[model samples]
Target: MKDIVLYDRNCHFCKASKRLFEKLDWMNVVDWQALQSVNRPDFSQEELMEEIHLITPKGEVKKGFFAIRRMLLRFPLTGLIGLILHLPFLKPAGRFGYKVVADNRTCTFRKK
Candidate 1:
């Protein structure tokens, strides 16, 4: 089973982010889905809207920054970045940074 990343298709930032992943996913280990278009029984609509989600092959779900880290680990080019993010001292900071970006994504894109 492949890992799936659910994102908001309607958001400009989300679409751009997906394009970046498409370019980086040379191994083709990850799949993409539009959150608004998919019905996920395991996750509520509200939960899906709050942040990005990565559904692992083992059925585990990683959300927000952790989701991005998990997806990054599968890409050889980005694996080092993921490893750095997972470092003991940086994990919290990574999560915080991701939240700040996630929270501001709409505004950032809207200004474009």
Candidate 2:
């Protein structure tokens, strides 16, 4: 089973995130899906657009920073960072940071 990630296709930040993570998926274990195209009964479209989502091979769902951490764990080079994010004290902070960034993703890019 593959680890599937759901993201908004229209969001530049989301698209960039997908590209970055896909590059780290050297073993080809991940499958990325655009939120507008996939029929995800488990989550509403609005909910997905609010943050990134990852469906684990075991059918567990992870969102935002948790999803990102999971993706990081899949790569050898980034696994250490992933483990750091899982530390109990850092989890909440990580989630908050992810929300702040995700909520204002448009700010990350602008017309030049």
Candidate 3:
């Protein structure tokens, strides 16, 4: 079973992140889903929109930087980087960086 990543489809930044992840997913260990397609009762629309969410095969749910961290560890290509991101000194920065991107959904880049 593949791990699932839930993202906001309407946000171009979110879409870009999804595309970037797709490129890094050499093993195809993860599956991407739009929040609109998800029907879980525990996940509120408002909450899901706050950041990208990852649901593990074992039913563990992680959001924001933690979600990205968990997903990265699944692929051999990014496993080392994922481990590095988990360092205590980097966790705060990781979360902050993800939050900055997530908070600003207005996409500056246009499809050419």
Can you write out model 2's per-residue Cα lDDT over 1-112, one digit (the tens) per residue?
6889898889877788788888888888789998899987878878988988999988899989999998898777798999888899998899899989998999996535
lDDT of 3 by residue, 1-112 (tens): 8889998888777788789989998888899999998998989999998988899899999999999998788778899989999899999999999888777767554556
Which stretches in model 1 have alpha-carbon errors above 4 Å? Answer: 110-112
Residues 1-112, candidate 1, lDDT per residue (tens digit)?
6898999998888898999988989999989999999988989999898899998999899999999998788888999998888888888898899899988898777625
Q: Any residue pairs clashing in model 3, and if so which?
A: none
lDDT of 2 at 36: 96
* Model 1 CA lDDT for position 74: 82
- How many backbone collisions does model 3 have? 0
| Root-mean-square deviation per candidate | 1.4, 1.3, 1.5
Model 3 Cα shift for residue 61 (angstroms):
0.6
Output the lDDT of residue 40, model 1.
85
- Per-prediction TM-score: 0.93, 0.93, 0.90
